[model samples]
Target: MKPRTLAGTCVPLCLLTAALNAAWAQDVPPGVGSESASRAGGNRLDRVELNSRQQSDTELRRKSQVAKQIYGRDELDKYGDTSVADVLKRLPGVNVAGGAPRMRGLGAGYTLILINGDPAPPGFQLDQLNPAQVERIEVTKGPTADKSAQAVAGAINIILKDAPRVSQRDLRLGLGYNVDRPTPSATFTLGEKLGPVSVSVPVSVFEWRSLNESVTERYAKGTDGQPSSITQQGEVLNWGHGFNTAPRISWRRNDDETLNFQGFAQKGQWNNRVRYNNSLPVGMPNPEDDADNKGSWRMLRGNLQYNNRFSDSQSIELKAGIQDARGTFNNLNLRSGLPRVHSVGDNQDRSLTQAGKYSQLLGEDHSLAVGWDLEWRKRDETRTTTLANGQNQLPDFDGEPFGARIERQAFFVQDEWEVSPQWSTYLGLRYERIATSSRGGSESVRNVSSVLTPLWHINYKLDPKGRDMIRASLTRSYKAPDLGALLSRYALNGKYPDSSVTNEELSPDRVGNPLLKPELATGLDIAYEKYMNGGGMFSVGLFHRRITNLIRNAVTLETPSFASAPRWVSRPVNFSRAQTSGLELELKGRANELMPALFDPKTALNLRGSVSFYHSRVDALEGPDNRLDGQQPWSGNLGLDYRFSSMPLLVGGNLNFTPGYTTRQTQGQWLDQSRSRSIDLFAQWIFNPKASMRLSVGNFAPLDGQSVTRLSAGDFTRTERSGRSWVGLGLELKL
Candidate 1:
């Protein structure tokens, strides 16, 4: 969340920027030389060790059979002031407005979240996760057929680290505080080696607060492309806490195979407060729609797997998992303390997935990999509210209102074939079967669906370890209708012509229409990467794709016969098609200290940056006027880092720059002034092996960072999103 006080926001932002400019002053991995480094490999019984880069959290999350995804992590500190939303914004193709994370330049409804490889979005998902305990984050940077049948843009997967190992007992504590927020966290790992048996378990607790002051709007429409928004300014705060625990037990059954079992549990909760004052008439001077948002979720999961090495050239592993989750949302709309307004709702979800993968070593120049995936899921929800005393709040369009339920199942498989020492090829296929039903609740629509897909990838190595190489892929994918599409109430403008009632059940709406085909996509991509001997790398790529059955929202009107309600119609319809393609380039590496290039073992310099340019054209938009959508025509980030390890303590800083781009700015929902660009800076110091500190500042001058919008007489514009500058400080200890 953005800070509240003017000084609080400006002061820290400046400090951070300054730090970034003077970076190249810090340290590297702790204890790499003195501490014993375990050799990476598996024991005869399948016990394995992973190197730092191989087990990176970033790559893990992006691993959907296909579709590219990315992520970033915020280092923990003594001043534990970290926001999940804030960290998410530093990632690619992700931005948050009004506390909602938009992925692939799309809305919330399109992206999906997963927990430890499971498809699940628990309440407090964004607010309550403990950043300190996150081992790493990953993204699927490509496309795959077996990934999903419903992923319109693509897929994202998050893999949590396996339980830590313990010999006796160990405890970890972290505490941090910024002028505006505080963080408290604890973690403990325990383990013991008994004869031939080894057991390990890790537990963590985290709590933090997020607060921001501002006003935001959802969407703005029309040809001019303005933003949509109005001032109902206020202060908001969120307090979140959560924990995770998992245990691992393993036995060396034999020389050829090993068995392992894991039990895990996770829980999170967050409370939010939003107060706004809208401008209006006396009776509605400012609608006081204060809401107390409280959410909680719980999960119990287990994993069992067996590994077998039949020979030196091949190996196979079989694994299965089971999970159960229930979520609760108690939302109350109010117009003051007088009476509860219009909404009270609750939801619950459950799912299970199982699969098996195999790897075969074919001589010294080749290898093969293949796998199959399967999953099933169900959900339920209940909503209760009062409209105008006598009118009912909801019952979906078909007239049922208790809740909604659904079942989805999918299966997929693929193979990776290595053709030679420098070349590799991949191919895959996936299929899904889905059935859904609803009654009395917003999710009530019964529909059945299925999809088939084929995908492939080819890689060439120009240099060793894939340092200089090119990769190309072709993929076909699809997305099915979600809950909102089949269940919303379709309507017409109440103004004049044919202003009539339009129920979602109307034939044109396809409420229960099972004939609706899935959204399909075809894409071609080419990428090249090169390693610069100086510890950095450069990469560039180009891609193009076509999408059919794309769902979109458009305005529909009748001849002054519509009902006395709202005008616009919001539903799922496969209107026009979309063609998108772009160019991406990235350069990152350690700065050289020697070639006037100051390079040293004690103090090191690093440079990292990426740029993206996309050309999107709309051929068949349902709207009368045809034009391109407004995302960014060109955007990217560049950072420079400096670190010094010579002192008893280590210090370093980094600067990040992102130039702004303009869209056809709209009004109302997304009104805002044009911001040319933005930048942030930071510096960090390690007091010792066990202690560290960080300072961050953002948006100095020329900072037309537009995050706030305003509504004028008719044309809407916006104030700079970021103020002059803001500063933040943090500290951390490993004891």
Candidate 2:
């Protein structure tokens, strides 16, 4: 538990280290047959993770944060964040890649989101996650057969704070600003502990406006044609707002029985307006066409879990939850005298997910644990577009759009066995039955099938020094296509019109075979950790994964366009192979916590952080030799903070830099032209244990025209990083 005036690193280093060391010395790190006596602090902070160990685990350059591996809690509290994407960007080895992210070469459909390790409803976009209620985020990299057969892209577990153990309570309020936008954001949270039960509720709201401007020059035809058009520039305005709320409850009825639950709900919306204040080509609108779009998304989630004891060495556990998601986006583009185009998008998802987990202590020397999970979900999505007299984005275009739906059901179970005091092994299996259903008079489609997944893990302790240990795991995984990818079609006027969308007879864009096989990957990961006799810590590891049936949307340029259809268009195709590989390293330690009381107030402070280095390659692609856009190869995060018992205030910050890395090169070079190096800096000051403030600046080292900017005016669509620029401010509060 946090003190009235919080101070010290997030975790209790000394105690956690001792607990683990004691267990390691006895050949029982974590499993059955291990003594049940609590050795030290394991659970305390609500928004941070603590190792509890002082020696620290040094196996790779990448040190898992206080939260879970992959995804963690530090993202939310490190700064008062408003969007989920903003928080995910700071994670190591992860690059936003502009729109979203392609984890280990896996697409969005393969990645699944869970609140407290339970599957969320379908149709939910990653960008819509609410940051306010998140206590921490754990990313389970690589395949997991039981959690979600669809976890080929990895798993994101969002851990919400359970009610505190005290009857007392705490609250927080915050606001932030951006130069180009006048949007104001605020957050409030209250936590209370009442004997055997605890509860916490948090609410947040934000309203913002932004401006976007761009300039482009017309390049003549192949023969250095006549002077085409002078430099052209356009301006856009965007407005957006969002709402989020979370409620958590925890009950520890005595010591042997306990219950924990966390629920979240959110609503987000954005409006975009564009104005090309310039002239058009031949027979185009004078002041150029104008377009506006309105979009909104809402999500609701709940998690419930309970544990009880029947006797001294006997116990049972059960956990269950559900998630509902729905959203709509509308875009209208047209000019005064040109044919109008109207595009609307909508999606609704409902799911009933539950699981039964059990653990039984079998005798004094042997124990066994097993669990089962069940999930059923469905989603409906539709996109429509038509051409009127004039469209804001385009002048002439006539077409109608379509809709589609997908339904799925999955079940999984696993068991852990204690081979002996010096070693343990885990083995598990899971199965999923995916049924994709389609509607709207568009040839109903269905993918009714089942797949089997398996996993294995082993651990060993080589020495009593508690420094030498080895862990390894092998998991088989699968990725299923969503309803949108297989059966959804929208009339993208200029991009894809009647020529763009048609009957499934022809493979659609961004998808391989309508009956495409699930992508497969086998992961092999082994790591070793050791604590030096004296001080420092170091970790390094190597990783590689191969993916198959990679999906990509290919342009059908030479393929003649339908007479009544538009000019150019595209469709989906299967790319034979896609591979990803990389190496990682992380090192940290207390250079010296006690330096003979250097200052007046108290003992000397401690300092430390980690550095990661890696490279990624698309390996193979069947597309028109396009550059993997918006991806950086060499990127790293370095943080150094100090706590003071002397001064009334503390100062600290982190520096993150990413050298420009183009995953792949595009044909026209739009991505390459905008490609360049960029870095961000952040610093915080704690006036007292009760109040603190921080400033985060991105593109702080921006040069020329390389900075961060939202291209879609009000939406999250970022065109590219702009020139040297920054945004900063301060925060203050009292517990």
* Candidate 2 lDDT for residue 162: 59
Model 2 lDDT, residue 705, Cα = 38
Tens digits of per-residue lDDT for model 2, 1-735 = 111111121122233345435534554322223233211211121002222233222322123211124334434655545556666665544445433544433345555666666665654444544465676666655555447766664666666665655543344443333334335566667778777788888776767555555653332211132223333455566688887777888888878998988777888888988765444442321222467779998888787888898788767778777778888888776565344567776777777666765666666544455566665666666555555633322222122223444444555555555566546566667766666555443345555666777776665656644455565667667666655556434233332333433312122223223454566666665656444543444445455556566555554434332234323334454544555445555544443432324532222233344444443344453343232333344456565444432222233455555554333322222232334444544444443345555555544444433322221112111233234333434354545
lDDT score for candidate 1 against the true structure? 0.51
> Per-residue alpha-carbon lDDT of model 1 for 1-735, expressed as tens digits?
344445565555476556534532444443334322311111111111111232232233222223343333322221232445445554555555555554444445444555455444333255344444444444444545445544444444554444443364545555433335546767666777776577877687877665545543322332123333344555566677888776777877678888778766778877887766554222211223566678777877777877888898788877677776666655555455543444445555555667666777767645566666665555555544444363444333222333333455555566766676677777777766666655543333566766667778877888646557787878776656554344333322111112233322111221222234566777787877665443345668787768777665433423222244334443446666777677877765445522334554323445556777666544563322122334455556655545433322223333334444443222222222344444555556544546655665544342434543322234332332323344456554544
lDDT for residue 50 in candidate 2, whole number 0-100: 24
Worst 10 residues of 2 by lDDT: 1-10
Worst 10 residues of 1 by lDDT: 41-50
